[model samples]
Target: MITQSGPSPDGYDPRADRDLPPASGRGDPHRVPEHFPGVSHHEPIGLRRRLALNRMGTFDWDLDRGFMDLDPGALEVFDLRPDEYDGAPMSLVCRVPPEEGIRLDAALSQALQAGTSSYGAYFRVRCRDGTPRWTHSQGRILHDADGLPYRIIGIVREASGELADSALLHSLQKERQRQTVMVQQVTVALSRALSVADVTRVLTGIGGARRFGADGLLLGLTAGGRFEVIAVAGMGGDVPEEMLTSQLDDTLPLSEAAVSRRPSFLGSRGELLARYPRLRPYGEVLPTGSSSFLPLIAQDTVIGALGLFTTEPAVQSTEARNLALALAGVVAQSLQRATLFDQERELATGLQATMLPRRLPEICGGEVTVRYHPASVGRDIGGDWYDVIALPQGRTGLVVGDVQGHDTHAAAVMGQLRIALRAYAAEGHSPETVLVRASRFLAELDTERFATCTYVQADLKSGALQVARAGHLGPLVRDGARHVDWPEVRGGLPLGLADAFGHDHFPETQLFLEPGSTLLLCTDGLVEQPGRDISAGIDALSAAFGAGPEKLEELADRLSAHLWAEPGSEDDMALLLLHRPAGSGAATTPRLRLHVHQADPSGTAEVRSALRRTLDQWRAGEVTHDVEVAASELIANALTHTESGALVSVELLPDTPRRIRLEVEDRSSSWPRRRSPGETATSGRGLLLVEALADRWGAEPRGSGKALWCEFVVPEMPEASARVR
Candidate 1:
């Protein structure tokens, strides 16, 4: 027996003979430990046997001297003989692989540096026969009083079974996570696919292969008792032409998968070729890897097949097979949804196209071009539409409108409204009347929907445009000099809502489109972005229009490209561009017309201002005073005497001395008679002024009313000013 008070300052050395303080005077080294009472004296020996039986071992490492003492059990854990390991710890380097040794060292260093009392690590060690065995070690760090680690005491154990279970679980977890991510990403992308083409783009676009963790992919759809290769991806070489389209009975992998409605997994390219001898013709071009073909089945119907190729061994694990099936299920569902959407979109678009004019009528003096793009979100079919109606009297009615919803109901309403507006305009109704009737028609539909619209009754020969709006964006005008102007058009409530609210009055805006000018009417979709201001989009549109090509078709295409280049537009767009080419030979006489409503007190002032502006543009400023005075008198007399609006026209008549003609037409058949007025009484002075101011003034029977006309003689304009406008 030996007695020891404590460990040396260098730290405890387990090999040194030591004894616990004598407990109750018992000094037997092999006796039951003092800490264990009422136990047999053989207990200490039994404890050692139990440890050995459990393949548990102990070690004492002297950090300063780099020496380690391993018990027989630890040697067994490493599959090493007692004589195989030298006293130096480095002697075990041959047993532990380089990476494992580095990892163990780093763990121990971290524990020591962080002042931890213990650490544990699992690593692989080579056996005597060069077989790798799993081993685990748990160590207790011993430090000097100054906190410097000088020794380590720990246990080593055989961990093959424990680590094997843990590794399998970890691998399963990792694979599950990868599968989950792949499915989630693919599902999210396909959720937005609105058509067959859109689905193909998502699955075969850039990074499509990486998205599926596959090196190559092939996709085909079954149609008309045949298979069509809709898309192929990640193939390093071109696909054989024969594979592009084949019958269901064809001896092809994809075709068979589709026909059988079951998945097929091939171990390698050779296996695939061996199974399908017909593929030998293109074996050289095929990818060298394992492959899988999964039939895309929806509602128990096989619609297509998807193939995945990888430059690795066969997908043999149950997890891999399950992942492939799950991906196929997701793709199948998406394809089903996209197919349905495609069919519905086609039907809706067909209906919409049928409602619209098959072709824009060829205008006498201007060209009409139109474009329509449906919403890109899901299966939405918007109500946006455009129609070019050839109204009577050589006039053209350009209409662009959008109903309130994005469905067949809205499209139906749009079609009805378009026809109604077209009919009214062709019947020679005023722009304001046409809109009022259209609003009433929509309201009568008895649906909880409304619509916005802009109707322009254009007199190309006269270069006059009467524009009316119902809660729609104003039209943009591009002049001959490439200048763009968004005229301020007064608006009323939208179609159905106007009738519901009892405010169906849509004011007509007077516009003059000189030769070589373009009037662009488009829906809000063209200039509305998700997170940006609509004004900004409108500004951008203006800039693009101002700088666009001169040809109407080219300009429309360019504008469409500029505004709709990016995807994710939530609404449909309908754009109609009416371009009035510069007069053919000599410039047609420039003319301007305006309407003055009797109910509007400000109509007379607005018409007067418009007259001044038009005169200035036409370089007829010399007679602006006489023309304005006579026009004011005529308009006032018509409004005071008649019960309807007045139509005023200012024309630079192309005759000798270049006379300026002013005509005020009234709906009333009552003609104006020149009458002398009492100086004090303000009665019957209109015709007197017209008579005194004009070189020639008279009244004529026009359509359903009479026209009071006056002409002003002026000198010829400069050649530059009179050049073709």
Candidate 2:
């Protein structure tokens, strides 16, 4: 039997063990073995105190002696040991029930000898009625100075209760695990914060105090002493939207908890009522059971508190509290991070705009439009730039280029490259030559970035064009000999990839002008990007071009709209074009006839009047004086130089400034040259002055001495004015 050594206190009692028979020689055989399980280090514990312990007890070893002093129930169920195992160590004697053959004393003795002071063991032991049961016995071995085991005092407990408890504990643990995984998934989703309400709702519904899960809250207390919820999650049901949105009294329980910043539990019904008298009415009115309030503390001060509620009182488990606290921390961090990121993005967007073009300059020969979109705000804008330069020869140079990335540096490089290209082209270099030099210049800049470009040179005179593609889109040539002839790739390379790329550039290829022909040049960004293959983009352009060039501006707008159709087409782009007129420059100058006959001055005057009337009818009367003078001079030369044959010729042209210029010729080898001021006779002066007044005068041998001619400006001069006589 287990025992304590001292006299018993109130509510405690002693027990006697009389299992063994009287010994033959030891103490008249009255003392049998006794067990003192779980004894403290002292002289020894008597039997009285052991009986008072709720978790401790002794059992019968032999059936005979235990029945005398025990109650009938105890007697019927157990038998005391009278003679077995006298004075044995408690570790061995206590396990006499549900017996296993692995002698407890022997095993414990072995363990003690090995310097093991305390040990726990599991084994089957015999019960009082001889039933077998699994028992777990534990004990501490007392050692003497020589390091040998002197006594083992311990307790033996039935393992059944503990085993069942273990199963319950395992189930609880699994539930906690599932809850934890769900919380994590929701936390991840909420972290994205695509929308404030959505993110908050998702997180709160999953784990916030606002829903039926663990929840945390942040609130601002009003002048009153009641707590008002600001943000909430994990609580069962809504926070009475009014209660959450309205200001609460500072002295209220939740607010007080927040202000004090102390962690408190409100599980019992009485505790809930005492903490919040207002809640008493709520409970009476609604029949609620369990809740836990955790203060939202920052810098040692409560700013808010987390409240969790459940239908059962078990809602206040440790897991709930832990999750609530963690959720509170996450909300605070997310708030701070999102605010900072938004501010930073705004600043970046402003900076990007400063580097982009604001407006496009008006240029002649074709319309111009420019659009610059910074690479999605908060990111850098790429090095794409476009410039339309009016060249000296009445030609236009269209340039577009892209540097490597989207950043302030790339944008700066783009500006510099644009200026450089314009300067080069203005110096009279062909488009190909300009690209070659630009490439070499870009390569040597050492920016550790590459660039691509396409330059188009338009010849206003012949309406001719030359294109150079530097790792850029080939210029789209539509409605020429071939309706869709891309810029010829005779030889070109991108700028900046290497050093030797630009110096010895190939000669620019020439293309003949066709009526309604158009040439389009652009950066790679225009034709090559995601959401569509380069070929598809090219085809799209071809289709647009084939639709006729009248809708060019509309086409550009359509292109921009198409780009946004697929977000992946987020590359910088630009378009440039050169259009040719319907009539070719090489078309024969307009022909008409101008005749001078050997007639009277009145006849000449009559002819002049007729010419003036006809020219005036055609809106070309400005040429009447020059035509009259040249005709008079030609007729005078022909009449003076030869006998009687007269001729009149007229031609029209479409060139600028001199839209119409003409030559008067007669069969005379003697060309008209300006005579000396004094030597100029009347007839000689006529042709001489004609030679001087006309832009150009000449003579050719027309199966005769020569054909003399004098040129005169037509009525339709593009820029210069004509003087008629």
Candidate 3:
């Protein structure tokens, strides 16, 4: 039976026990007297009531009895009704989050098994409203006489109000630091990009995706007021081509961003679909709950746009949007520069192509090919040129040259110099004389540009060559012995520099071409590069030449393909190859022999007729009329000047600049001389007439008499008539 206390004389409810101390008193009801002899039992009971008033709690568990008790404050912290908590430790522990409950149970079990005096833990617990709060609990274990755990008493307090806030602040700070580093990395990557393609590649690769935390990224560039998807990340080939190629006005989000020149965020799939109905299909495919569109602006111009998609709206934080804008700025600047570079490069390439030769000349008994490569860096135009000119008298002139500097000025000077060299060579000047005149011409114009040049004139009939070098690398020759060597030829000062400083004569080198021989002429770019010696380049070229293909065109391609394979080659390159076909005892020129009777002036007519016949047989009728007139003069001179029967020979030199050689041999030791013929003297006019009608005429003394020889140039025939019998 229980009795209720009545009202006291002081007007306080007598139901409240007067002997009981205030709730604030320190006391423990369950403490054994032996353990806490000085503490009163009412003191612990008062402490429990005070903790409950302060919203802090106390709990006690009789481990052996499997019963638990919680103060009103503990029940309130756990958000448990009186009936909900059954005074079982398991029932209270079940209120915690599943993982935290397991952890707390394991801690209690460990303390009980070890018979430890105390243990504490922080864990998550759910309130009656289903909201989670961090709670800290401390408990002490009581043991029985047998040294086994018997009871546990603990205090429980809500910690989330202060402790959780501190942890959240720390996490946010770390995230900010990580974002700063990511932005720095993106800036560095954009800085290294050299071209539009490079920028696009980097932005679409792993670097861009990781920084933005995007599920899909679309990069659209503006050209001619039209927008096109230049690159896409996270969306593989499955992205529709039409979506990538849409015009700027075709879409809402992209156009709106372009017009506003700011970033726009669609926070939910429903909003995106409602605002951009056309993008609904893509939204379904990408499964994006949020998306952002940013205008790529540079120098106040909207050059492009960027679209980023994320599956969860949480990923689209304020920090992420700021990062996206920063990344857009970097990409915009890099892409703008690259786009300009691409345009300029295309224009330069087209201009350079127009300046080169359209076709290479074809020569008999030899093959010729040329290649020109511009600088891989900067503008793709430089001052390098190669030309194959068909000189008079069955000879071909090959030229390769480089002008100082690598700009439009250098290229202009190079073109002028090439034309001047060709004009001088066509005028029948020797290689050295041509360079001397070219140097003078360049100096007079005063373009302030210097040039290095090499010229080689090869005679098709005799296989003889005349080479001249003007501050240029010597030609590499592969002889019939299969030996590759750079001919020993001293070069003069480069053109334009020599005449401006002092007058110097250019040197000429004479060489003969044996069967199966090849000549290679090139600019320094083909052999020289950064961190490499010119000598090493020359040696490497020699090796490449030695191992090159037998075909002349293929060999030129092979050498270029091998040398240009290395990166960072900034100089312009020009290469020319001249190869003589292989075969022993091959006649350089076609010959037709005829014996002329002595003391017969009429034999001159016969010689002309026979020469015309042979020219017809060789399919060289183009020069028949000139050959006849020149032959008639040479035959008449040989018969009238020498005291011997004439041996008339007509030989046709078949090459680019065809020539017909007429030689009339006699037994006299007299060489013909050129003289001004009087109107009355018909005999002296014959030699005069020969010089006027022929391309070149000369006299050589045979064993006893002189052989009067003259050559007439055969004009280039039609393509169909170029074939020889």
Candidate 4:
């Protein structure tokens, strides 16, 4: 054996090494050498054999001397010869990469300082051949009798394959987490979308473009068997107008995607050009590198298609495609719901319009105008209506009502209630009696809906108004100075609720309208809003009413504009305004005038012929036959009842709706009573016949002579004819 002197490259003295007992045998290295402290002298041969079979490298370290003894396998792992690296632990430490060498030194130091039994560290080491390998080193530390560290025996193994597998698994898990979060966020947003436009804005917005790496997006929907561009994003003014407005045929890619109900990809400009050569001339309008068309399918039906364009072809990945497909499914479902709602809303609105009054009746002292606004949210159809009914004796019935709920059922119920109210009022019922009968009728129908209504019957000649309310807002009255005031009116329960609770009495409040006063009747929607009390809306309405344009139509427009300036209201509004003009008498120049003697039955015929000619001249020939029959009845009654001959007068009242007024006067001071005639009685039906033929008819005492008068609402004349006379 050779005796090395001094430090031997690891600062180990050869004199100290010689102090330990010699090895048992060269072939049996398993026999613990005296210098290796942690090894047993009688160690099992199986442990040493197993380590050698698996090709694990082993080393022994002297803690006090700072020296290492490497086995032949250990030296082979470092790619060094036994002569070059044997007993040189410093050289072995130098072979490790700098950072890993420091880590290994720290582990050994910790084990020695703490007097621990084991130490382990994993790090990269560079072999003498300049190859890097990941390694895990584990060792056991032994102490001397004085409790000072003496030696360490350890084994090292390669761990490169295990680390690579762990790293791949971690990356895959992170990507899965990210995808799950994205899908959840998109699902929540799509659920809240209320309309097709709302869905389109969310789909092509910022979040969508970033996730799919799309430069532009286009949405096409199938309508009437043709593809139409419903929405677009990121396409600037460069896109042609034809692409937006014109319908697409089956040959187009969008139509193909919808027909096939599958996603299709256009990989390159050449692919697009090959299929759609017509788009080649507008190259800039097309995507640069790639495009994808996805079918939006819901419940096994294709409703539309989505198109995405990207500048780089490689940006379209499998993950992005799957995400797009999932989003398309969400959009398809939401759009289907929106489309059905829109169709139902339109039908409800049409039915509601038919139920409302086609034209407001023009009264002698007041001008009537109306405006209706549907709800701004959801289906947009609700139960709000206004009407002007011409009652007997030159009185007008003003009505505004709102049925509960904003649905088809509510609208249907509103129509029926309006007709019932008009019929009761036309049959000479008082304001309070009309509402009581209407409530009973509504309850009998069993529609399970309630309604709030306000009805006002105004005597135009006397300016006396009788108002009855059924849980509705009282009318706003504007004075001569345009100061608005809400009159005190006691209200009963809503229509259906009154009969349900055994309460049918609706009290009437009488109001005298001064000349130039304006009466406004409106549904609750006009003065009610979410998050704001109805009182606040009432205040705003009062302010709007005070500031008027003086013209009835313009004032109506102004009221609607001011009330609904801010949108998102979920109620329908109906407003009716009746402005009584300053003067209360007849016009100086009537459209037509006739005078006849009532005694001669032949005079009735003469008066009828003269009335026909005058109505024809006024372009009101539509009411000529009705007016003539009414005149004949009134003149016959005057001749038969009164001893003196009567004066027959026919004058057309100048108003928006032209009126033909027929008055027959006799010296007798008797008023005609509308008697109930039996089915077979022909004589007592004369006054009843006149009432049925005329819009309004009654007998008024004029000084000593009683004037039996009736008014017929004639067709409005053209602008040129109205201006003529």
Best by TM-score: 1
Segments in model 4 whose C-alpha atoms lie over 4 Å from true places: 1-178, 204-213, 245-251, 267-275, 286-289, 311-315, 362-365, 460-462, 479-481, 499-503, 512-517, 548-550, 561-568, 581-725
Task: Give me the displacement of residue 14 in model 2, in angstroms.
Answer: 42
Looking at model 2, report the run of 10 residues with the lowest lDDT sum. 21-30
The sequence of per-residue lDDT tens digits that candidate 1 reaches over residues 1-725 is 11125665546546352222212212221122234345476655443334455666777787877788776556667666657888788888878875456457545644653588888876677776777676789998878788988778889986666655686646644664676577778877888787788889988998776667788889899999999999898776899888799999749999998887666788889999999998898887667888888788777688999998887756455445546666776788888988998898888778777877888888888888999887766566889999999888888999999999998888888888888888898998988999999999988989999999999998888678889999999899888878677765667899999999999999887777888899999998999979989999899999999889999999999988779655657788899999888873245666666778789898788777777766765567477888889999999999999998899887887787788898999899987777767878778888888888899999899988999999999766677755543
What are the TM-scores, per candidate, against the unseen true structure? 0.64, 0.42, 0.54, 0.55
RMSD of 1: 18.0
lDDT of each: 0.79, 0.53, 0.72, 0.72
For each of the candidates, give the backbone clash count: 0, 54, 8, 0
Sort by lDDT, best first: what order? 1, 3, 4, 2
Superposition error at 2 for model 4 (Å):
82
Best by lDDT: 1
Local accuracy of candidate 4 as per-residue lDDT tens digits, 529-577: 8899889989989888988877889999998877865565668889998
Q: How many Å off is the CA of 153 in candidate 2?
A: 36
Better of 2 and 3 by lDDT: 3
User: How does candidate 2 score on lDDT?
Assistant: 0.53
Which rank order by TM-score, best down to worst?
Answer: 1, 4, 3, 2
Over 440-519, each residue of candidate 2 has an lDDT whose tens digit, in order, gives 77776778887888777766456555666677665665653334555334444568663554234533544433555666
Off by over 4 Å in 2: 1-175, 187-352, 374-380, 459-463, 477-491, 501-503, 510-521, 526-533, 536-554, 564-725
Residue 451 CA displacement from its true place in model 1, Å: 2.4
Residue 270 of model 4, lDDT score: 70
Give the CA lDDT, 0 to 100, for residue 436 in model 3.
93
